[model samples]
Target: MLISRFELSVARRQLLHNRGQTLLTLGVVATSVTLIVFLATLIGGLQRRIIGDTTSMIPHVVVSAPERLPLAPWELPSATAPAAPLFVGRVVKLEQRLRKIEDWPAVVARLRELMPGGVAARVAVAEGQGVVSRESNRKPVTLVGAVPAEFTRVVDLQSNLAAGRYLGLNGGEAVIGYKLAADLNLRLGDRVRVLSSEAVSADFLVAGIVDTGIAVIDRSSLFLNLKDAQSLLNLGSAVTRIGLRLDDVFDASRQRERLEQYLPYEINDWMRDNQRVLSGIRAQNDSSRMIIVFTVLASGLAVASIMVMSVTRKIQEIGILKAIGAKSRQILVIFALQGLAVCAAGAALGCAVGWVLCDALGRIEVVVSATGRTAQLFPVANEPFYYGLAAGLAVVSGVLASLYPAWSASRVDPIHVIRGQ
Candidate 1:
C-alpha cells in the first residue's frame, strides 16, 4: 500500500523514539560517502600532476616521422644500409613543401641551424630501447639525441639538470637521467657504449646528470648530442623527429596540423602519443562512481533492521488499531512511511557529513611524486553535488529494505493480539 498522511505521522513517532539508532546509521552511511569522494579527489590530483610534468618536459606538439612498423626484432641489418652503417633514421627530402611559411626556416630550423639568436625549432633523434652496461649489470635505457643548447630552447631540459654541464653539439658526451645513472652506477666521468640496431656502436662520456622525478623519464632516459646519435644511426643530416616550441603551448593541435601540411613526412602531437594514459585515467574515474552506491545500500540495511524490530514491539498496538477499524492498507502505509522517514534523515545527514569531510580534506597539503609539486588536496566546488548522488543511492536501498518488513507488518492478524489469544 502507498503511504498516507496518518501513516507518515506514525512513522515519524517511531523514529523519534530511537534517537541513538537513527544517528548511528546516518554516521555509517555518511562515512562511506565521504571515503569515495576523497578517493576521487586524490586520483584527479594525481592526473593533473602527471600532465603538468609531461608538458613541462615535452612539447605540446612533437613531430615525428611517418608511421612505420619499426625495424625487425631479429635483424640488425634493418637499422641501416651497409655503406651508411651508424645512421639509423628514416629521411624524406622536402625541398618544395616546408621552409616556406614566411619565416619558418629562420624561426624553426633543425638542430644544426638552431641558434641562440631567438630561433625556436629543434631536431631530435630517439632510440626507443638500449642497454646501459656497467660492471656485470645491464639496465635498459631510452637514448635521446638532440643538440643540447637547441633542444633546451624547445624543452626545459636545463632546469632538470642536477649536475655537471650540458653536452656541446660537437662533443661526444651524454647527459643521463638521475635514476638511470644510479641504476647503471654511472658518474660524471664514466663512459658507456651505446649499441644501436644499425650495428653502429659509439661511446659517450657522461657529462651530466639530471633528475626530472617523473619515474618514466628519470628511470629510463639519457640524452646525447643529436649529431652523435645521427652519426651512430648513419643519418648524416636526418633526425627522427622535429620538436616545436611556442608561446601558446595549448594551441599545439592547430600548429601540428599546419606543420603536417607544410612537411612531406608525418608528424604527431603529444596528446596523440599519450592517448593510452589518458584513456586509462578516464576509465578509472568511471569505475570509482560505484563506491557511493555501496555506501548508501549499507545505510538502507540499518533502516530496514530498525523498522522490523519496531513492528514486532508494537504488534499489540497494531492489533488495537486494526480492531478500531484501521484498514490493513492503512497499517502498511504507516510502516512504509516510517522507512521513508528513516532514509530521508540518513540521506540528509550523509550529505552534510560528506561536505564537511571533503572541505576539511581539501585544506590538507600533499606532495605528489609524479610532478614533484605539493598541493592542497581537495575536491573542487562542484564536488559536493556528488553527495546528492550518494544520498539517492542510500534512499533506494532504504525503501527496498523497508518493503519486506512493511508487507509483513500489514499482514498481522489483529484478532489474535487484540483478544489476547
Candidate 2:
C-alpha cells in the first residue's frame, strides 16, 4: 500500500509540474472522444430515420409477375371484306395482356407462415396506368387497386393521409396522392375522370389525399378499390401483385426465399427494391468510420508526444529514484497510472461536451432529400453504450501511447542521468 501511494503521489506531482503539457494532452484526447460520440450519435439517428421512412413507403416483400406481355390470340380475325364504308382496311386484332396472378390468397397464406410471426399481413394489389383529369389539367399516374383494410396493414397508407378519410372502397371513392391532387387542383368530394388504356373512363369521388413524403410515389401513383380496378382493367378476379409486411424487415430476403416454393412469381425484397437509399446510408457510415480512424490516430499521436517530453524532463528524477532502491516495475506503474488518469479526466470532460453538442444537433432541422421530407429536429440517439465505447477507445489509445515512454523511464541509468560533469 505504501509503495502504491508513493507511485501515485509521484505521478500526480509530475503532472502538476508540467500543467500546460498535461492540459494540452487532455484536450486532444477530449476532442477525439467528443468527435467519436458525436459521429456515432448522428449516424445512428440518420440510419433509423432513413430505414423507417423507406420501409414505411413500401412492403418488406413484393410478389409480382416478371413482365406484362401480350398473350397469343385464340382466333385470328377473318379476312372477309368490310361491309361498311368506314372499314376500308384490314381489321385490327385484339391482344390481351398476361400479367395477372391467380389464386393469390394461398400464396399470401404461405408467406405469412414463412415469416417469423404468423400474423404478418399480406395484401393483394393490381396495378395499371391511367390518366387523371380535372378540367384541362391531366397527368399520367400509376393506379393501384387494393382492399382498404388489408392495404392498411401492408403499408402506412391510412396514417399518412394529408386530407380526407382513407378509401372504404364504397361509393366509388378513390384516394389520390397529394402531388397529383395539387397538379389537378382537386379537393375532397371533387369528381375527377380516370381513363384506362382500354378506353374505360369513369368519374371517381376523391376520398383522400396521401402525402407519403416520397416524391415519386406521391406524384405518380394513386389508389382505388380492388374491384373497381379489376373492372376497369377488364381483369376478372385477378391481382397483379401481393405485398407482405413482416415483423422484422431485415428478414425479407430469407422470407422471400421461403416463399419461392409457394409461387412462381418474382419476389422483390425491400433491400433490393430501395438500393439507392441504402447506398446513401452505407456511404455515411463509411465516412464516419474514416473520421473516427483519423481522430483516434491524432489522439494517440498527442498522447505519445506529451509522454515522450514528460519522460525526457523527468529522467534525472527517475535516476534518483532508481538509485534510492526503486524497482523498474514501480517506475513503469507510475507512468502508466499517469496515462490512465489523463484518459479518465479527458473522457469525462468529452462526454459532457458531447452531450451538449448532441442536444444542439437535435434542435436543428434536417431535410432528407431522398425522402422528400424535412425533419423538425435532428434525431439523436443518447444510449449509454456510445459513451462507454468512447471511453474504451480512449483507454486503449492512452495505454498504447504511454508504453514506450514508460519503458524509457524504467530503463534510466543512474550513472549517466545524474552526472553533473
Candidate 3:
C-alpha cells in the first residue's frame, strides 16, 4: 500500500522537529561529496597534462641508431639540464639500409647521417646548470645551445617567448624563460653572463624572455645559438641526444621497431624517459578513484542515519495510524517517502555543489613532467570530468543508501505501538 498524504505530512513534521540533526546530516553529506570531487578533479588534471604532450606535441615515429661505443651519463655544460645516462653512439657509425622505411628522408638518417630533419637539430649541445643573477639574487636555470628555427621544428622554442624575440644563429644572443628573467632581473637587450663547466668566461645578450608557464622551464631554461653552444661546449658537432619527432606520437613503439632495421641506436619515446614520474601520476589517479568510492559510501551512511532517526521519532504517529486500521505496509510507505525526499534532495544539491567547485579548482595552476623535462599546465588542460564522475557516484550512492532504510521503515510493528506495548 502506498503512503497517504496525511501520513507523509506527519513524517515531514517529525523530521523537521529536530533542526540540528537534520542540518548536521546535510553538512556531512555535502562535505563528503565535495572532498570526493576535489581529489578526482586534481588527478584528472594530471592525466590530461601527461598525455597532452605525447598525443598533441609528439609525433608518431622516431628513429635513432646506437653508437658503437659505450654511452656515459652526461653532465650539462652547466648543471641545469636533467641528469641522465648518455647513449652509446657506437651504432652511429653503421650505414645499414632500412628494410622497410616508410617516410622519405628515412628516419634512419635522423640518428646516423645527422642530415636535415634528423632526430636532433644538427648542432652541438652545451648543457649545464647556471644561476642567472638579478642584482643581488640569482635563479638557477637550464641552458641549451641550439639553432632556433631547426630546433623549434623538433621542439617549439619560439612559441615560449613572452617578450622581445627568439635568437637567430648569428650568436652573441640568448633567450631566457620568463621566470628566469624575473629572477635575473633581465629585459630585452640586457647583457647576461652564462657560466658553464665547459668555459669559464661566457656571456650573451638577452634577446627575449620565454614563458613556458611550466615553473621548472620558466625558471630554469635558457636558449643559446647552436654555434655558441658548440663553441662553448667544445663538442664541434657531437650531440648527446637525438630528439626524434614523429608524424604520429601514438605510434612510437611501431616506429621504434621499424627504425631498428637501418639505425642500430635505441629509440625511446618521451614516456619511456620519464616512466617513474608517469607511474607516480597513474598511482595517484587510482588512489583518487578509490577515495571517491569511500567518500560516497560515507555519504550513504549519513542518509541511513537520518532515516533511522526519522523512523524512531515517528512511533506515536505509527500507533495512531495502526489504531485507525492502517496496515504496517501503508504506515511504512509514508516514512519511506520522507527518506526518499531527503536522499534525492541531498543528491541533487551535492552534485551541483561538487560540479561548480571542481570546475573552479581546474583554474588552479598545475605542474607536469615528462622525458626528463617538466612542463607547466598548457593549452590541453582539462580536469572537470573527474568532479562530474564523483557527483554521479554520489547520486547513485544516495539512492542505494535510502533503499534499506525505507524497507526497514515500511516493516514497522504497528500493533505494538497502537497498544502501547
Candidate 4:
C-alpha cells in the first residue's frame, strides 16, 4: 500500500527522536555495503589478471595428429590368432614415436576458413626434446620451431622479452628463456650447441631472452626458425602440431568442439588443459560471493534488531495512534518507511565511499616479479553493475528486516498500553 503523508510524517518524527540509534544503524549498513563492493571488485580484477597472465604464453587451442595406439594380434584383422596351444602372453607395447600432422598447411588453411573471424592466429610448430649446452653447462630443453612473426601472434613472446631481440628469419639464430640463459650462464650472441633426440645437432647464437612468468616455459624452452627446428628434429616437411589463438580466449572450448567436428585430427583447448587453474579461479569467485552474502545478512540482522527495539520503545505512541482514527496499516507503513529511509541513505553513502576507495587503490602499482613486471595490487574493477548489486542487496535487506517489527508495532494493544501495562 502507498504510504500517506501522515504516515511519512510519523516515520520522520520517530527517527528524529532517536537520532543517535538511527545514525548508528545507518553506519552499520553502509559499512556492510562498502565491504561488499570493494571485495567484489578486487576479486574480479584479480581473477582477470591471473587468467591473462596464464593464457598469454600459451595457445588457446592446439590441433595435432591423433594419438597412436597399439593393437593386439586378435584386435587386428590382418593378424591371425595362433591356435590355442601356446601359453598366453601380453602384446608388446610399440616404441613411443613423435607423430606429425600430415599436410598441415592445408589443415591450417581449413581451420582459418572454418573459424573465420574467431581465429586470431594459426601457426604450425615443430617441437621436440633436446639438450642445449654452453661450454660445460648443459640443460635439457623443449625445442620449438615456428615462424617468429606467426608464433608471436599465437603466443605473445615479443612482449615478454627480457633482453635481446626475438628470433630473426635467418638460420643459426635462437631465442631462449631467461631461466635457461641464466642456468647455462649464457648471454646474447653466445653460441650454444643444441642436440636433438634424433642426435642431429646445430649451433645457434642466443638471439633473445624471454621471461614469460610461467616456470615451465621460462626454465627449459628454446625457440628456433621453423626450418632449423625441422632439420634438428628430423621432421622433414611435417610439423608436430598447429596452435591457434582465438580472438576471445574463453571461446577456445567451443571452437575446439566445432573444430573436432570439422577435422579428423586431435583438438585440445586451454580450458581442458588447465582444469586445476580454472577450478582455483572458480573457488575464489565462490568465496568472494559467500563473503558478500554474509556481510549483507549481518547488516540485515542489525537493522532488524534495531527496528524491534524501536517498536518496543514506541508502544505508547502506537497505542495512542490506534486509540485515535489511525489505521493499523498506517502504523505499519510508518515503521517500514523508517527502515527504507535509513537503508537508502546508507546504501548511497556506502557506494560513494567504496568507489573512492577502489579508485585510490587502483592507482597504486606493485612490482610482481624480479623482471620489473608491475601490476596494480588492488586492480579494483569500477563496473557500475557491482555497485548497483551492492546497493540492491542492502535495500532489499532493509525492507525484509523491517517486516516483522512493523507487524509487531501495528499489533500493540491500545487498552493495555493506556493502562500503562
User: TM-scores for all candidates?
Assistant: 0.50, 0.77, 0.55, 0.79
Q: Higher TM-score: candidate 2 or 3?
A: 2
lDDT of each: 0.66, 0.81, 0.60, 0.89
TM-score of candidate 2 against the unseen true structure:
0.77
Clashing pairs in model 4, backbone N/Cα/C closer than 3 A = none
Window of ten residues with lowest summed lDDT in model 4: 85-94
Give the Cα error of residue 54 in candidate 2, in Å.
4.5
Candidate 3 residue spans exceeding 4 A from truth: 1-22, 43-62, 68-159, 166-206, 211-265, 315-341, 351-383
Compared with the true structure, model 3 gives a TM-score of 0.55
What's the lDDT of the predicted structure labeled candidate 3? 0.60
lDDT of 2 at 342: 93
Q: Candidate 4's error at 165, in angstroms?
A: 4.2
How displaced is residue 162 in candidate 1, in Å?
A: 16
TM-score-based ranking: 4, 2, 3, 1
Q: How do the residues 314-346 of candidate 3 rate in per-residue lDDT, one tens digit apiece?
A: 666666666777776666666656555555555
**Cα lDDT of model 1 by residue, 184-262, tens digit:** 8888889988775456777788888877767777787778786676666565566666676655544666666766666
The model with the greatest TM-score is: 4
Clashes of each: 7, 0, 31, 0
